[model samples]
Target: MRTQVVIVGAGPSGLLLGQLLHKAGVDAVILERQSPDYVLGRIRAGVLEQVTLDVLAQAGVDQRMNKEGLVHTGFDLLFKGERHRIDLSGLTGGQKVMVYGQTEVTRDLMDARQAAGLTTIYEADDVQIHDFDSDHPSVSYSKNGKTQTISCDFIAGCDGFHGVCRASVPRKSIQEFEKVYPFGWLGVLSDTPPVHEELIYANSPRGFALCSQRSLTRSRYYLQVPLTDKVEQWSDDAFWGELRNRLDPEARENLVTGTSIEKSIAPLRSFVTEPMRFGTLFLAGDAAHIVPPTGAKGLNLAATDVKYLSDALIEACVEKSHAGIDHYSTRCLARIWRAERFSWWFTSLMHRFPDQGEIGQKFQEAELDYLIHSEAGSRTVAENYVGLPLNFGE
Candidate 1:
């Protein structure tokens, strides 16, 4: 009936925030609109920044990740039948990304929450938040044909873009910035050895493609498709055929084709909402911002959002200090905006926009050319890809 915090949506961000609060002796409950199985079934990007892995450890869920997640020190960028390696750790001073799937992170957090005897309300329908503008806020939902209300000191709106939390806010106070890419990524997950030791981003006359992996034995590959394209149009053979066409001969030769375990088309987009907080309700992850996956920032951005939010909540509840909570939005937006810029820039550089025309195509090529030849440009890309350090408050 009551808790210090009621988190909407039991996805990684919500569950992660709950884990941090629980560890700090804070009372929090997670409410989900779907079952755990449904949550884990969704496939997402898995480029883990150094900070994200550290956050998982703080939540007591990184033991498996540290052991099993693939560490990528660098990745290759291909254009005009040539591959240029960007040394991430060398450019970022020993920082690297881990190739642990987002599903794995969520599972770890879920397991920790269950082991800790934390309350998680799954399959709760029509979840709603109230009084977030006031000191005492509450979340209510229907379950088993009965209504339940949770009184809480604060609310976390981790329920994603279509989620009710952000949509529930009054539109008059919120400002939005968005760009829907003219293309989408048609990706396939397979149980074959990865085409390469590290991820590859390629730009060819055919289009843009990415070769990524979930682990040593599981590969994830993507090819840019028109917004009008359908997954049904792409069988495993067709997808693999299109993907190989976009890679250099060396990469193409090493590519392994197989039955697709999962396939989907995800539209690329960049979006941000001003002031991630509305009174006592704090928005985190897709609930507040979204980034194109070219920069591999979706989950890492969410990790920082929740990190700032959890730190604020812990400071407010444990230390009886409101400074962090009061400055939550200001702190989060600074970093969120930087990430949005990086994703947009990287997407513009790597993807072929239908509207960009021939001149635009040449410019994209020129930019990649410079990145490959110039140490400064390569370092810039490396720093962003590996993630910027977390710095907040003056």
Candidate 2:
């Protein structure tokens, strides 16, 4: 197989990159290790920053999102038994986040790609990249026990953190920066209606708990716990009890409990790789970096990466200049670092570290109190939450 570009993952980054390139009249092939059903069924981040929504709108993928997505003007910070709302829209001049699952976004992108007759190979195996230093880069893979090689002018490594594309690059040329949190999130999806209208980040003596909803009948919640904690050990009653104690202390009545639909654990970590491009291969999304889920920037950052990468590819292919491709790394890094810092800051602010002594806990509590009570602090949170201003210039 031959194409202008070979995308090495069917996740949001690779799929969106392929779609953007196709919209610009660039032919690209996408290969995925997972089946189409699995890719579409994966559950992940849900919050969409205003900048991300803009990109989706431009790509003509916002029609369903605008209709089905839930919009939030602010979120509540529950501390000291009081609720403080950060006015995201008011502080950011009408900017707000939309609650849309990553799965839905992937489904929409896949539908659009298929409707456009884009080539996507699912259940692909043994994918390998070769000759990234040359003008022509190729990907070798197996499907249905049959091996095949795809030759392309360039390769976009959107295969994610554990992907082979990143490993294909020389180790000496890579610099890794990472921080693993001491805790992980115990997430649950239930068929219960949300207790509150807006998302809530509640701090309690037990730990940090987040209250969010997926739809009218489906609600999602998370509890911060030790990374080694086992989900099987947590009974349904215990989970509901923890949520009620952490999130609803004020209610005189018992908080309602619903049947648990999905329960899983997610580790908290901050990771980033410097210079997202190497030779003819450019990395986007989780393939390049990962953020702690506190800031809800994972999917948003991937979308941002593809936006720049697709534009660079277009310039390189159309103008016959290497400038765009040459600067792809530097360009993507600026935005990536911004999100990295934001995610780190948010994670530190919300999570309780066991290593932090009494003084650290006091400081965290004081900071949370200030963020809820102080106008300036609330504004700072609002600006970051709504969306950072868009900067296309690398």
RMSD (Cα, Å) of model 2: 1.6
**Deviation of model 1 at 334, angstroms:** 0.5
Report the number of the highest-TM-score candidate.
Answer: 1
Please give each candidate's TM-score.
0.98, 0.96
Go through the candidates in order and give each one's C-alpha lDDT: 0.92, 0.85
lDDT of 1 by residue, 201-310 (tens): 99887789999999999999999999999999998999988898899999989998999999999998899998788999999999999999997899999999999999
Q: Write the per-residue lDDT of candidate 2 for residues 57-127, one digit (tens) a residue.
A: 77778889999899999998876666778888887788899998888889899999999998999989889
Tell me how candidate 2 scores on lDDT: 0.85
Instruction: Tell me each candidate's RMSD, in Å, in order.
Output: 1.0, 1.6
